[model samples]
Target: MSWLDQVFPGTSSKRTMIDRSQALPGRTTPVAVPASHVVLGHPLRGEDPESSAGIGRFPGYQAVVLAGGCFWGVEEIFWQVPGVYTTAVGYAGGYTPNPSYEEVCTARTGHTESTLVVFDPGVVDLEGILRVFWESHDPTQEMRQGNDVGTQYRSAVFTVTDADADLVRQSARRFAQVVADAGLGPITTEIAPLAEAGGERSDGKCRDGRFYYAEDYHQQYLAKNPNGYRCHASTGLKYPA
Candidate 1:
């Protein structure tokens, strides 16, 4: 057995193995909100001079979570986009709390390597954000992006509000048409409504899925490690005029 099995004790070898089965069709999961909603009331990262400086500068910022694949490249792509206030990499659409990078990579957690993008809506519209997202990765690759194969790499947009959800659906439909016109296969990105922040389900139980901030060193990984592997693909395809 490996060191992980030794440390965790009850973990089975088969349980640790990654599952590649595509998520079931129309399998709708409730989107739980992060435990701490208000940044000032309960900050995920306590008052650090740098983070405070960053947040203070952007008063009208909004948050959106997107899961593409291998968040290293996804986060890098959004960090460079104009009007983005901040970008943090985390695990979402999963059933584990505070999951480690290793656990998420194994695919058992049901989490998708995702990025939380804080941007100024006044500067960049939702459509622009979706445009960049759709263009940056292949949405049709079920549960996989390039060599990264697992549920954690599945394409998804986790919207926090009804308006955001509607926009996502509309934009996806338009993008789907564009892809179809270009002779590409159908877009398979998942769109779902977000649950209330820190609320338990109808069973009066808290689900295991929670956003765990990745290791400090993993933050802005591509910017830190310039020669990192990037699996992103762009068709150079534009939306129909």
Candidate 2:
């Protein structure tokens, strides 16, 4: 298929990510975005739209942003997992405000294709969630996940709190040795607090930025198109219970 085929299209192996520095120069202005979520019908930013929409927060529900290659599989996996409230695929850890799918695929926006996972801690704690994340793809391959090779496909855990940041780092540290013991080099996952714009500081830490949802076509894409492309590489390592 031509590069013009579509973003994360068919099972064809042609879809691949490129290095950030070697990618196209993305724009300074974020592309215009949709207002409401296609699947959940919630505003794409700020307060929990599901909860605010009157469904009310699921007991112990919390949010975290995850990036591991194409978000189609990542988002689908979480959506099916128990304890998940809702999931939305979007751009994260990037400079552009609301980058378009084309801009992100060009590897210019500095954004990793991300999944916003809202879950109920009562059923699945952070460790359970992180386990699914680690096992989902090869984190050692920096700046890419398998054949999806670009900064946008890089493995990342964008945390909203300092405590969550520490948890991610600690998990990465422990998992690094596990991967090494299994002969993989090391986990190249980026564990950092979400970048924040100026004047967004609170409690001495800038909160996670406004999550710019991806184009309508990308939301719960696999669910909508069951036979679409899916490239997930699980390491088979299990997280501690």
Number of clashing pairs per prediction, in order: 0, 1
Per-residue lDDT of 1-241 in model 1, one digit per residue for the tens?
A: 7553465454443233232233221123322233332222223332231333112223466667788888999988887788776776777665565667777765666667888777778898777888899988988766767666667788888765668888898998988888888898688786754342123555453333334466665667787689998888556676544
lDDT of each: 0.64, 0.69
Estimated TM-score per prediction?
A: 0.71, 0.74
In model 2, the runs with Cα more than 4 Å from the true position are 1-60, 196-210
| Candidate 1 Cα errors over 4 Å, as ranges | 1-59, 196-210
In candidate 1 the C-alpha lDDT for residue 87 amounts to 74
lDDT of 2 by residue, 1-241 (tens): 6443354455232233333344455444534445554555554454553332212233356778899989998998888778777787888765555678887776656678998888778899877899889888888767766667677888888766668888988888878778878888578786766644211344342222445577778888997899998988667775554
